[model samples]
Target: MRARRALLGIGAAVAVTFTLTACTGSAAPNDGAAPSEPASASGPMTCETILRPSFAEQLAELGWSAQQSPFRIGEHELAEGIQCVWGDAEHATDVAQMYGWAPVSPEQTAELQQYLEDNGWLREEDGDVVYLTEDPDVVGYLEEGEYGMTYQFASGWVALADTKESLDLITWRG
Candidate 1:
């Protein structure tokens, strides 16, 4: 019960944080880009069973492409080759803070980076620091603190984030 209350409190704090920022998904387009995601329906709401097919279709609708070989880290799968990119932030690095898109403290960034590293989602660098994945194209930009969010699509599995902050708070990582 206490744990549940704490969880609820954290969720409320996140909501308040965003409400104060008043940011939207209106940042610059991601890359040279492809067709934009449908305003009303970006794609579909997916889960473990429907992740792959739904994700592929969503990216396709949004202009992101996939490659044959996919990256597998633990239970999560990653796709490669970006068909197209679109977001307010240019590169993955600033997908969140470039504008009021999604604000994150430096401490949150460290917490998130460490979380990914402790888990299998990140790769070790020189035995100490860690990165999201092996692909250079797979950069980190959309970061969510504590229960952090990351966006790194290689080829197999990718989850689209509506906003930089949304990427951080994604319910599903793989």
Candidate 2:
């Protein structure tokens, strides 16, 4: 009886351990290799790959280099997506241009649009393109001061830019 009780206790402990491990979503050990990144809609968008060559050259002429950064809405940083900022080469302090792109499901796209609407971002249409901007007065052009713009593409990419021209620079291969 004592031996049977001990064996049952051990079995229960093993089962609990397994259950907890499964609940934690731990994957099989990869033998010290780095874990693989999640695949993007087309491919992972990097600061180098997403920009048009001409735009990249233009940025270079202005002494700006692209850096990977976080995408923020208000004060909250989005957990997913790729963000790029163009700034001075040495310090990266002058972040006058920035953009973010993420592939979204239809539901997520709708939720984002609703969020923008609820947040009082003004929506403006320019031919086939729709832009949501923080300033209603900003139509097609970005003036001297700062502004935020968001665009949703039919190809499952939702993008945000600090300026309209910055948004225009992205090539959106996704």
Candidate 3:
């Protein structure tokens, strides 16, 4: 019985040592390797980041400011991304411009394209793609009445805006 107890104790000690080594071995904080951070940490996509400098200046000239908001297509809110509304800050109802940017999988892009087609949004001209030159593989769509536009980038980003000019002002690096 005493021999068995000694063996058990030895096994327990070995197990504890293995566990400690395993836990600490991979957790070296100062091994000269760069720390992992989210892609966005370097330059996050926000209302400011997405806008062209001239457009941002124009909005400022017009006394318009941007505020974060939820992005929606008709009544359906997108699950991820950043959306911004630009207008008079004091009057909440005076918001006349808005934009949104979201990353999309190829499948999601196809679904969005279908959704736009089904809802009667017109496909924009190939030349219109020049507006967002940062994304060479972008395609644009336009909706009348409300004057809304949507852009799908092959880089896996989708942008929505209330006006074509708003679309023109966007620059996405995704």
Candidate 4:
């Protein structure tokens, strides 16, 4: 019960912070990207089932192509919790990955933020998540418990823009 109360308090704080940041920040641009095809899952949502097909189509719309082979980090055979990548064909530039975990506590989230910040990732509040990225292009991660999302950009600013657009299209959807 105490832990639940603490989590509720933290969640309220996050909501207030997001509201203040959204009110202060410049309005995000309307990119006219299509909303992703609605994702459906029987069990826990995995990266492959939810992220790939929609993101592939979204990337194609943005003029990028998907690589055939995907790399993984964990021992698990399941691809999503491990990692998933999409990139160009010839040069192998412009890549993105999606994966996340639920922080055990607010302190863990803070430690994660500080670690990323120490590594030179600038932090910004987007909705309920604090996103970390560098300038000129938005390539970074937005972590909120079980919904953390990370991305990197190599193809340049256009790819970064498309990434943000696609994220906006799909982030809220189930």
TM-scores, in order shown?
Answer: 0.21, 0.57, 0.55, 0.38
Against the true structure, candidate 2 reaches a TM-score of 0.57
Minimal lDDT window, size 10, model 3: 130-139
lDDT tens digits by residue: candidate 1, 1-174: 353334334435544544443355423322212225422144333322112233334334534332222323334333331112222232332222101011123554455445556755544333321225322233333223322223333222233332233333322221
Give the Cα error of residue 34 in candidate 2, in Å.
Answer: 32
Question: Cα-based RMSD of the predictions, in order?
Answer: 16.5, 24.0, 25.1, 15.8
The residue pairs that clash in candidate 4, if any, are 94-155
- Give the CA lDDT, 0 to 100, for residue 136 in model 4: 33
* TM-score, cand. 4 vs. native: 0.38
Q: Best candidate per TM-score, number?
A: 2
lDDT of 2 by residue, 84-145 (tens): 86667775443345667666667766676667767877776655445666763534243345
Model 3 has an lDDT value of 0.52
Better of 1 and 2 by TM-score: 2
How many backbone clashes are present in model 1? Answer: 14
Q: How far is candidate 2 from the true structure (C-alpha RMSD, Å)?
A: 24.0
Flag the better candidate by lDDT, 1 or 3: 3
Identify the candidate with maximal lDDT: 2
Estimate, for each residue in 18-136, the C-alpha lDDT of model 3 and write its tens digit.
Answer: 44544665322211122364335558677776655445565666577898866556565666677887775765543346667777767876676666666666665443231122121
Residue by residue across 1-174, what tens digits does model 4's lDDT show? 353344334334533544454466532322222235423433444433434344445445545543332222122221222233444455654343333222123554455556656766656664444555443333223323322233321111111112232333222123
All models: lDDT? Answer: 0.32, 0.55, 0.52, 0.36
By lDDT, the better pick of 3 and 4 is 3
Q: After superposition, how far is residue 172 of candidate 3 from its true place, in Å?
A: 2.0
Model 1 misplaced regions, further than 4 Å? 1-28, 31-101, 123-174
Poorest stretch of ten by lDDT in candidate 2: 26-35
